[model samples]
Target: MNISWQGVFPALTTKFTAEGTLDHAAFKHNLQAQLEAGVDGIILGGSLGEASTLTVVEKEELVERAVNLLEGKVPVVLNIAEGSTREAVRIAEHAAELGASGLMLLPPMRYKADDRETAEYFKTIARSTELPIMIYNNPIDYKIEVTLDMFEELLQFENIQAVKESTRDVSNVTRLRNRFGDRIKILCGVDTLAVEELVMGADGWVAGLVCAFPRETVAIYRLVKAGRLDEARTLFRWFLPLLELDLHPKLVQYIKLAEVHTGLGTEHVRAPRLPLVGAERERVEQIITDALAVRPQLPDYLAL
Candidate 1:
């Protein structure tokens, strides 16, 4: 299960039952879909996966189930988004023990850590686990940007091998390349800018919309990498509206609704988060419905 640190890795939405329990059946259904569609890896318990609402035991269950299900076809990456260094470390250590192939580590949650604190938070976790880590450098949402200076300090840790570049600035990809070269792999974290980032030399996509449309997502990545931009752009254009849903505050509900339409999942989100309702639900549904009505006939991208 060695991660190649390249290609589409779905920051999957955790499936739950109506009573608010982990829906093992639905979760496995989507995981199989992702694998069958040729995703490079599976990232569990991410922001898109509703990490804040999931219990520690539930997260561990997800890791164990994914490990057993994928069985090494692709790496199972558990995301650590804890508020404290100690809690983050504990989660990282447990993920390693549970056979997670790697970790997607966010900066200190809740309290906005400064540059020094953020670097130390990452360094402590990197030292605590043998598993490789992908720094979730999403300053726009998380508010703590891992600057190039911070990365310069953190790069001494060999395990800090990649980054989820979600700053929404596509140019940052080239900046990262210019600054660090091949030392750290860059995976575009924003769905809308995925192709642009990849074109600018990003190594992979840590995608959100891929949870519902796995084949299209994987096809776009392969097409871009294979130098088939025309076909990729055509498919991506069709996917744009659906992909934009990932940018919303209620993205979990929106994506799960898309999943339901595709029969990949249910719209059963955890509490503090409700399923989309009324005009909002209709709006999101129309977008998904419109996209599905004319879903593109993908090329033989697997053969590419």
Candidate 2:
């Protein structure tokens, strides 16, 4: 499961049973869809995958299931969103033990640790595991921006090899490359800006909406990288509406709903979250329906 992290790696939504249990069957079905759509790798326990809601045991099951199911078709990278360095280290250890291919490590959860503490937390986790790490730098949603200066401090950790850049400022992509060059691989984390990020020289996409439209997601990445801008733009124009769903605050619910329409997943989410209802549900459904009504005929190159 050696991954280059140079293509679309979906930040998949976690499927749940109404009784608040992991729905392995549903998740596997979705994973199969992603694989069939030709994603570069599989990322488990990410923000879209409800990593925050999973217990250690639950997370372990997810990693194990994904690893076994993928069978090395793609790297199964686990996401670490923890509040303490100790917890991050422990999760890193667990991912390694479970044979996860890599980790998407977030800054310490809840507490916005300053530069030193944040760097230390990531360094500690990086040191704890052999798994390659992708630092999740989402200042908007996660609050802790892994500033270029912080990344400079983090450069010593050889295994911290990539960044999921979600600052929402596309300029940061250039800034990152200018600062670090090819030292760190950059993956676009925000969905709406994914194309822009790719155009800005991001190596891959850590995508959220791909949960529903896996083929289209992979198509755009391939088309853009292949310098087929006209083709990519044509597809992206149709994709833009659905892509905006990933930027919503309730992206998890919105995406799962889209997944349902696409026949890859269900709308069952764990609580403190509820299923999308009323106007919200209608709004999302309309978008999915409208998009599907005119879904692009993906080129043969995108087929698995």
Go through the candidates in order and give each one's C-alpha lDDT.
0.94, 0.89
In model 2, the worst 10-residue window by lDDT is: 295-304
Off-target runs (Cα >4 Å) in candidate 1 are none
Candidate 1 has an lDDT of: 0.94
TM-score per model over all chains: 0.99, 0.98
Q: Judged by lDDT against the true structure, how good is candidate 2? A: 0.89
Q: In candidate 2, which residue pairs get closer than 3 Å at backbone N, Cα or C atoms, i.e. clash?
A: none
lDDT of 2 by residue, 233-303 (tens): 99999999999998887989999999999999989888777899999889889999999999989887564
Error of 2 at 243 (Å): 0.8
Question: Cα lDDT for residue 47, model 1?
Answer: 97
Q: Which stretches of candidate 2 lie over 4 Å from their true place?
A: none
Model 1 C-alpha lDDT per residue in residues 1-304, reported as the tens digit of each score? 5677999999999999889999999999999999999999989999999999988999999999999999889999999999989999999998988999999999989999889899999999999998989999999898999999999999999999999999999999999999999999999999999999999999999999999999999999999999999988999999999999999889999999999999999999888999889999899999999999998888999898
